[model samples]
Target: RPAKKELIRSGIVRTAGRILSSAASTPAAAEKTMALLEKLSTCTEGRAAIGEDGECVREMVRRLMKCSGAATAHGISALWSVCCLARDAGAQAAAEEANGLTKVLLVMQSDCSEYTRRMCVELVKILRVKSTTSNLSPYHSRTTHITPY
Candidate 1:
């Protein structure tokens, strides 16, 4: 964990993000980079670094499906980190704009853990809610559930 922080301190996350978009980077390399990014996302500086790097967010969404199974999981976990854990609205919007919802749903149907699936569901719901609330109808405003207490 400390190693990850030190790497973040060294500003390597941007280089890692660049690797994600480079054609010369192999699948194994990409996976390793993603795993590192996923681990780094646990820290505030890491999440901030990811959010600050426009390529990091866009390339993550761009390479969502092209990577291997573990890479996909790590990528999704990284996305969940910045978008959900850090509550980054811009990242959420970028994911939504890139049609990451379909990708998230597809990954949810795969062999990932329930926690990851829950993250996928939350990402979908959060983006959906944000998109809908912009032009909310009366029914959307009213609570579907009612209680007398």
Candidate 2:
């Protein structure tokens, strides 16, 4: 049997390709695949679900955003779905670091598409809401809207 890292890497690659292709081929299937990808976007081996090579994930998301059809909505929604999972696994640090996750969210906020902007705002809210605590509440409240994304 291969190491878990190998298995995960394979899955990541497979999912990335599926997400890209699904952007055009099948919105329903794409949504489902995106869900799985989001699930995989959890902490693993002291790293993030999206892993160090987030370029692939980011690119896929960028491509999805580039789409101007119904598919784009599904893809953006799918990305949002994963942000919750990522927040859960990686915690505040995940949101703060984790390979430009915040940057992507900010970019989505400014997306020409209204749906994408709404989705990005929602994702930021989710991260802030989920991670807020007595000690961090003030910090989050003050910086939530001003962070890079």
Candidate 3:
């Protein structure tokens, strides 16, 4: 069981890294990458695989800033899955350090697809909850102040 899980994780992370590295040059490729991300979001091991790769998390966060439509939605969904399933402090810290929460807020306010908007909102809520409950704040503070426009 453990070996199979490791194999699956390794393959998914490698594929995600390849797609993310090359998908920036083409919209169709980006869309396909997002589709793969969304599919990966459906499973716990997949989410852990993505979270374990710092580069992958960073790339998805970057996509949140640059990509749109389905790609954007999938990126947000993937991050949400990581936040919920991985439950890893490093993953949450990476997202927070990358200003992912702020980007999600901006995306929520933009004229994105309904699915995108929904995922952004959900991601924000998840981050906020994690921050408050886990004391993940830099100051060990208890409150998370996210102002939405």
Tell me, by lDDT, which candidate is best.
1
Scored against the true structure, residue 114 in model 1 reaches a CA lDDT of 81
User: What TM-scores do the predictions have?
Assistant: 0.79, 0.38, 0.70
lDDT of 3: 0.69
Best by TM-score: 1
| Residue 135 error, candidate 3, Å | 16
Relative to the true structure, candidate 3 has a C-alpha RMSD (angstroms) of 5.8
Badly placed stretches (over 4 Å) of model 2 are: 1-15, 18-56, 85-118, 125-149
Worst 10 residues of 3 by lDDT: 132-141
Q: Residue 40 in candidate 1 has what lDDT?
A: 87
Query: In angstroms, how far off is 136's CA in candidate 1?
Result: 13
TM-score of candidate 2 to 2 decimals: 0.38
| TM-score-sorted candidate list, best first | 1, 3, 2
